[model samples]
Target: MAMSVIRTKRGMVKPAKETPLTTLDLSVMDRLPVLRCNARTLHVFRHGPEATRVIREALSLALVPYYPLAGRLIESKPRCLQIECSGEGVWYVEASADCTLHSVNFFDDVQSIPYDDLLPDHIPENEHVDPLVQMQVTKFGCGGFVIGLMFCHSICDGLGAAQFLNAVGELARGLNKPTIEPAWHRDFFPPQEAEAEAQPNLKLLGPPPMPDYQLQHANIDMPMDQIKQLKSSFEQVTGQTCSAFEIVAAKFWSSRTRAIDLDPNTQLKLVFFANCRNLLNPPLPKGFYGNCFFPVTITASCEFLRDATIIEVVKVIQEAKGELPLEFGKYLKGECVSGGEDPFAPPLTYTTLFISEWGRLGFNHVDYRWGPPVHVVPIQGSSIIPVGIVGSLPLPNKGIRLMTWCVKEEHKLPFLDHMHGAMDQEPL
Candidate 1:
């Protein structure tokens, strides 16, 4: 497949002109205090003869109604209405003829580029406190192209963003407009009441970690068949079907614990996110925005880790999903605020691993005016060893592609070796 670049009119906004920072805008920021933490880069390419015409056609269709695809944040009214932006928030770039698209190469990193380089050099110091969602497009002499994107974590989670990009790709391919228009009705889903009921049994009860703990990524690249086989073997061994995430997480947690030689009797925990938008009595609408999500935690003692089977860990994780509720979201918000002052709250056990599954959703669809991306990868953030997984299965003849990045200091060979071993095993 040949990648094409398209040039379209830039999406409109306030043009950084009048009313730079309106009162309503400031208020909107106050509600969404959590800054964007996720950043990603994407690269696209083409091989064989240059297919400029085909690529151009793809780009033109990709840019129509470009306003919704690329734009900046604009002012919005107070708690009365949802926050809104004026233009599309997406951008694009074209590749030179010298580059060629290879049928074998595709990735999530091809779509994400750091926004810091695209921003103005000077901004109020306060503005720096909150991250800006930005992207850049670059063309390689070899006819390859790259698109980059930055997102504020407060606005959308990985699943939500993947949904947005998929919609953009659908638009490029002349699919129907996005299934759900973006919604920012923050008031509709405000923080939960402080006095909400608590599920004591479901609460996380693990040992506290040292202060100032940091997060790291464990990068492991393997074939897609291997991952699928790993999942299948895990299920066969444990007799419990698990998502790619659960499988990789269980392996990491197990291997890391064993590597550290932690006490065999100490309790261990696995904390993962659970979207709460639909869990409410009156489920949140497509646009009903706010942090309407909470973490689902699974706890097992060190003895369990040292002696339990992978299936047992997976079964415990499956059971933990049952405790998620709308109230948990509120509790989480309160805890975030409370922990801001107290250093004693469990430090998320520096050992906790955060796995984000993006490839399963076909995120390469964010074409804009350019053709499909070749690679996409997330940038580093705070204390979480974030592992982003992307790429198609059944090995596209080119094979499955996996991209991961973790702190170089944390030795991840054991976990990688385990993954390799699991992949080699036949599916149960």
Candidate 2:
């Protein structure tokens, strides 16, 4: 099915209350070399043409506090990024798809839909002197529609992006104000040593390393009972409680390693973002609107991963996560402070894997008058590593849904089989 743009225009959504010009701070995580660009997300809703109007009007209000999104990024000295809050506004577009929502199997896998057509046209870099946030509202023939958001990663992370969308949804419901007002103190962390030069020029994660091969994607659903069983099993083996994400990551890494057939002694890296919102001595103000997570890594040999039980691997991951410096101030003192070493950088190697969690961010709760979105899908730029873990929102049965991209198409089936096998193992 084809998608045709009904109207395309630029919107300047200034703050509902006029505020003076401001320069916002950019987090070291925001300056990660690989993430210095736009990220896309698609939200599916069952609504009509009127939904577009609601979103347009609501977005204008949402931009009031998130003015930086309406602004542009300036590449200044020191090679760091800064937002110029000039109120240029975000890109807005309205389009229609010839096919009905039912005709597209969006829930099964993200690849089932036409992401390029559903998302707003990515403006050429040379012509991107306008805004940081761009959106497209598409109405399907079945009266159901999809909202595509293209956000500048330099301005916000997944949580920050969700905060913005939730604000828009609140306004659409005729609320006078957003539940949480945004806080944009980029200078939250003091300046520290510049570590950009001290770090190795290793590949930052996000882009596909092998352009020649197609990565396969799949979603594995684990019900709450299964999750509890898995966690219980882990605790019995390790004598420590494990979060759902940790347990799942352990299983996933093991399966991925076996599927890829790396050398038994080869060293493999696992990295994931650890939220630092409440880790600081003086915690960041509530509702801080920016990137506040850093990557933490744990290494294991392929043979170890292949032979270790899920509980044993979970212990290693849990210990690595527990050992992370809890002081938010220390994060500011690290290489990130100087935009040097982004500890959160995705591992750049054929043997590395990244796992991320999003179940708690509440993406499924974005209610834009038409009701909450039926499905929320994240779409990263082409520069991202294709093989990684994506923990999604919980299913209705309180089970978790996990989506993953196996680096090579040939490895996908084996990976999926191994993963399911791990999850389905009965408690011993």
Candidate 3:
């Protein structure tokens, strides 16, 4: 079902009330070289068009508390970014599509629909001054609508963005204010300070860390039963329980090594993010929105993985994951830099896979008077999908789906076969 989306209007949406005209400090995580980018998402609602006026008006009211979003991201000194709370407002766009949700099967076939069109425009000239947040609402012929959001990664992580959108939803329901007011205690983290000087050669996060080599790929929806059997088998042999992310990631590494047929001595790096919000003594505030996830990386040689059992791979990942608390502590103290900020970070290669846990991030619940979204999709326009990131998303049947990106077209089917074949491989 081919479709077209036309933009009807576009403008800035300022806060409903006057906001403070002062600069807001940033968290250490916010200043990390890895976090300075935009995160885009699409929320599809099954019901009608109260969204045009309801969301626009509610967004204004929601901005009073999340005013930093309306501000511009500026260099407070040099590499450090601070929010200039000028209350300029967020970018809003109104659009309509020529098809229905049923026509596209509610984006079950995501490739057919241009998820990019649902996102806000990228204005290079206005990059520095434009709103840290940009939103677009596209209405379908069936009265259903899609809300596309582009949030500055420096301002918050995926969970934090969901919190802000939840606030907007509350206001849309006629609530006077958000259930949990936004807090700006970024002063808790002094600028990268010592850590900043250590990595003077690190590049910013928005641009591809590696440009010349890019992987064109698709999403592979791994069935829940497959994941379950894999997880159960690992624990049965190792007698150690691991997360769905852990087991799946381990198998993914092993399978890719076989599919790509990398050199026996080729070093394989698996990078995944661990949420640091609760790792601290006193966890960050409920509304203390900022970047709080750090990448945890594990490297192994293809020869070892080729001969290793699924249990061995799982144990390797579990060991690396256990270092989060220590690494996160060093990061905040500016003693060490996260992988993304490390000038000597591991070189991304065909064997490297970045796993991001996108399952249950609450984007599916971003209500706007209508019920929760039927589907929440992540859109990667010009943004780099580093090394075919394998992300976990919820399947309606209470199952887990792995949206694996980066496997070359030629190796697609074989990569998927290796993906599922891991379950059948007997340990040598």
- TM-score of every prediction relative to native: 0.64, 0.88, 0.88
- For model 1 the TM-score comes to 0.64
C-alpha-based local distance difference test score of model 3: 0.75
lDDT of 1: 0.45
In the predicted model 3, the residue pairs found to clash are: 388-405
Model 3 over residues 323-412: C-alpha lDDT tens digits? 878877776665644554552244455666777777656676767788788767776544234444344443354555565565666667
Ten-residue stretch with the least lDDT total in model 2: 194-203
User: What lDDT score is found at residue 182 in candidate 1?
Assistant: 59
Cα-based lDDT for every prediction: 0.45, 0.72, 0.75
Runs of candidate 1 with Cα error greater than 4 angstroms are 1-38, 43-132, 173-179, 190-218, 221-240, 286-291, 326-349, 360-362, 367-372, 382-410, 422-428
Better of 1 and 3 by lDDT: 3
Give each model's clash number: 50, 11, 1
Best by TM-score: 3
